[model samples]
Target: MQPTKTNIFLYLVAILVNLLSFSIGVSITWITSVIPKVDGSTITDDNPFGRLLTASEISWIAGFLPLGAAIGPLAVGKISDKIGRKKSLLILGCVNILSLVITVFAKQTVLFYISRFLAGVVLGSSYSVIPVFMAEISENHNRGALGCSVGIFVAIGMNFALVAGPYLSISVYSLLCISPLLIFVPGFFILSPETPWYLAARNDEKRLTKSLLKLRNKTVEEIHLEMTSILEVVVENETAAKAGVRDLCTNNTLRKSLLICLVIICLQQCGGIAAVLIYMPKIFEAAKTNLAPEICAIIVGVFQVFGTIVSSVVVDRLGRRILLLVSSVFTCLTLVTLGLYFRLNLSDVVWLSWLPLFSLVVYIFTFNVGLGPVPWVVMSELFPSNFTSIAAALTSSTCFMNTFIVTVTFPYLSTFLGMANCFFLFTVVTICGAIFIYMVLPETKGKSLQEIQKLLGSCG
Candidate 1:
């Protein structure tokens, strides 16, 4: 709590690690702004591509990112465990840089698809590695806030893409987004320390001691106590043999943790966040609001960033379960309202046209407050250090898979069922998700990693 050297160091590292989220945000949301321009617009003589993309090509460009992301985490997760979190993150940065380069030079639809797919790989890698890195480096009290920083930066990235994409050409936007990756790659290398938890798990006592010293402002006794706690969990994990997919499935605690993680991520995706983000411009276009669709998207992105900042501030104080429960309930309500607004718009309800915009803003805000970040934070807290990589990979993969499904099918589903009916279905899912969380999730405020592990283990 005091402004010691260690505290300053940890906060600096937290800031650096969270920058990865910005690249992720840009990658995922870039298409949202880019698609409208490239889909139907006339190509100027000066334009390098010289052709507009077809609808089917746009769909592939949109859908393949998550598909590639689904594959990225599986490999990156294992690589993170084998190498280290820092190195894995650097690799992600490299991937992002390469993807941007491809995007800049890409003249063909296939090249665009490949660039987007590569971007997805960075996203998948970041989601898998960054949580583990934050959890291992942060003190118990700071863990939740640091974990939620990922969401904060992600929101910032989304907003940046939304606000800038309309103004800048695709090439300019791609180049601008690469700045963060460039800064993050070297900045992290110089500033960040390997996590003490990771060092202990790898049986490197000297580095573990050094890492603990850099991360903690406590006395030698307190540092020893913390080291012992981490070691006990590491030893217990080792006793079960090497941690893997089988260990995650066969061990009772790890299994429960994996299930909870997967369920949370599924609910997070199915709750319609991806659908809302992907279709924001279309939604605004359909609503025929006074503001331009791009402007409305910027507003929504601003709200999202604000909500994530609020979540970072209160996640430790309010606790995870309460925020998630509250978030789910309110999000369901907003979705229902949005559904009704869309349904009414189909009628002669001209005066209530503003409801869609209002409801979506509220919905995005509520989601970022809890459901957006808490699930990832809880996922990091749930698994032991030994199993964190594989579990994170599996969970991150599941999240992206669901995202892919929702992203790919949303246009068709909304077309067939109508936007109102689509949202109505999501409302039902939100309700179910709320009930599950209230009945099952444990409060993880102020608890150490080992304590949380024991608490979860005892649940079985």
Candidate 2:
């Protein structure tokens, strides 16, 4: 079914917002060499600790922005249901621009850390809420595509940054990351037409008609009929006091949905994607590649972005479950191979650089296609409108904590275990996660939040 032109516009909006939000850090990965060591004055790897950092510390630092970004969905979500989504997005865009400014001048490690922490907050709000906002505006038929655009933009943002970062100085790169905030170019001046459900929830039928007409390009009568389609089965939420955090847990359906969201995000982290993404330099270094760590990292970012775009093409066409499962299987093999190749003697002959390089490339591809997109998609889809505000908030918070855990620990973990062994652990976790998804996660490819609730109710 063809979506209204408005839906497509919203999809583009989602893509731009996500791309702008994620690309800043992705691009920064290339500039880490320029990030300065020994409290931001020295360029050498030498530090008082004598170990400056392992690949894991590098990986951990790579993840810090996401650690902050973890809050994006929840804090913004708490307010999005009350205020308009567009406005919430506007706040994030403005903040993104400012954060980039802070990053550009940051010299001290403390200053850079503060900049990243704030950037995390910017992403924390924009990326999480944007996808949910898109899902709300779309029907079940286009929900996956709309939602999947989150990943697509994420990939594009990373790609754009990767290409931009290596060639550009660190100062120019910071500004570039925030430039995608121009989403408000058309967004702010446009109608800001309401979602059909949002209009219905407000019980302002007259405004609902106006919003739907603008979206559907339908007549008054047709808009009314379409509004009824969503309103007929929709359950309007209670007062704010009722939607509190504790209340979300009390709802059995919401509880299960929360668990689903929680596990998927944890899986995303445990899979060590952030570690891989931010530390692409270290991954190549471990593999003994001839390329400079900075340049090799950029290549990984490029491939990661391409893989995400390819996933967008196949995502809805293939269905979420199968894609996720395939990602799990291939990811396991790739990680294991990379691990073993580095551990075992593989430098015996020329042309053997293919083994580790090929494994890392395929591993990146598998991750982009499956685990990378699925976490955001599933988290965005699993909640109903009634519970969306609090549920999304909780989900984002959980994601943030996991982000912190992985970011902080991954450095130490990678050092203790070889990057090879580190990946082997991730592989085992991902395999187990595949089993959990198969057994516990339900297919949400073509279902609205209402229909999904019914399915979950039935499962109960």
The candidate that wins on lDDT is 1
The lDDT, on a scale of 0 to 1, for candidate 1 is 0.87
Candidate 1 regions off by >4 Å? 44-48, 217-222, 346-348
| lDDT, model 2, position 9 | 61
Please identify model 2 stretches exceeding 4 Å from their true place: 1-63, 71-74, 183-191, 236-241, 345-349
TM-score of 2: 0.87
TM-score of each: 0.96, 0.87
Candidate 2, residues 1-460, lDDT tens digits: the string is 6666766665554554554545544533433443233323334423323334444344444555766777666667777778766667667667667766876776544555666766777666665666667666766666776666667667766666656665665666676665656555355436456566666766777877776666556678766666777676454444432666676577777678788888877787788776676556556666677766666655666777777777777777887888888888998898888777767756444577767666767887888887887777777776666566566666666766676676667668877876767888888888888998899888877777767777876775
Go through the candidates in order and give each one's C-alpha lDDT.
Answer: 0.87, 0.66
How far off is residue 402 in model 2, in Å?
A: 1.7
* Best candidate (score: TM-score): 1
Residue 279, candidate 2: C-alpha displacement in angstroms:
1.0
How many backbone collisions does model 2 have? 4
Worst 10 residues of 2 by lDDT: 39-48
